[model samples]
Target: MKHFHMLLAVLTLIIFVCQALPIWMGKTAKRSAMITGASHLIYTLLMLTGLWLFWQLYQVAGVQHWAIAKLVLLVVAVSATIKALRNQAVQPSQAKAGMMIAAVGYVGILYLAMAKPLLG
Candidate 1:
């Protein structure tokens, strides 16, 4: 289950990068990533699998601050990604800011998962 969760996370990362490529590399083909059924599917699976994995972990080790923090970060990251992809009418700079926020959120999620600090 953990492996599956990690796989989905990696796929989400790749899809996000692809979607953001239009801003980063100035290629229009990558813009197709913004509104694809595939992107939606990937996000759905990533979220569901992550929740499933968290449930299983919670059963074993009980809840921790890192787990809660990671879940919150996941919400923010996905929200940022969705906003970034959906804002076609906004200025390109604003859209780019959304993408950066998403990326940072994802990094925070990953870091929390790995560090798993048991905050008091």
Candidate 2:
């Protein structure tokens, strides 16, 4: 399950990069027939797996502060992804900024999940 979850994350990241790069390059990002559907499926799986893992941990340890932090990071990631999807040629900067924010948010979530640090 862990390996599958990790694989999903990597695949999602690859999709994110693929979608953003063209738009960032000032090119029209025409959606491929499968890209949108694949992205949705991948993200759904990734999120579900993450939630299941968190649920298992919660059953044993209750809700940890870091877990809550991770949830917040998830919101950030979703927001950025939405912005990237909505970006147009008029405001390419916003799209790229959103993509960068999402990259950081996803990396942060991965780190938080692995480290599980407590805040003072």
Candidate 3:
């Protein structure tokens, strides 16, 4: 069950990256970007649900560092999505940089979750 949840989370992350890259690269139109943003939102919700289910089933003690990092990355992703949706104009280079940073943050969270390395 934990593995299943992890898989779902990975899938969600992949979808998010796919949806974000086109916008960040200035390849997607405003309308299409909005649509993709909505899709990402839905995928994120699903991923969270999977994580919740895994926790309930496994009764695993939460990893504080992993959870906090994941939440921070999620917040960045949400903020980027909102900003992208609000502005129809092509994203400026700065916004693209932010998007790339958020992507890296997301990957970091995933790696921390999987690796569970000592934080010291």
Model 3 lDDT, residue 10, Cα: 68
Q: Count the backbone clashes (under 3 Å) in each candidate.
A: 0, 0, 0
Judge candidate 2 against the unseen true structure and give its global Cα lDDT, from 0 to 1.
0.82
Local distance difference test values of all predictions, in order: 0.76, 0.82, 0.63
The reply for model 2, stretches above 4 Å from the true place, is none
Q: Which stretches of candidate 1 lie over 4 Å from their true place?
A: 26-35
Q: List the candidate numbers ranked by lDDT, top first.
A: 2, 1, 3
TM-score of each: 0.83, 0.85, 0.63
Those runs of model 3 whose alpha carbons end farther than 4 Å from true positions after fitting are: 30-44, 50-63, 88-91
lDDT of 2 by residue, 1-120 (tens): 878988998898788788878877877577776998898898889889978888888899888888778778877987897777677466788878887888899899889878989863
Each model's RMSD to truth, in Å? 2.4, 1.8, 3.7
In candidate 2, residue 84 scores what lDDT?
76
Arrange candidates by TM-score, highest first: which order?
2, 1, 3
Worst 10 residues of 2 by lDDT: 81-90
- Best by the TM-score measure: 2
Error of 1 at 66 (Å): 1.1
| Residues 3-112 of candidate 3: C-alpha lDDT, one tens digit per residue | 66567666667666765676667765344666576666666765577557646634665455555556667677667655654552554665566667667777786786
Clashing pairs in 2: none
- Between prediction 1 and prediction 3, the one with superior TM-score is 1
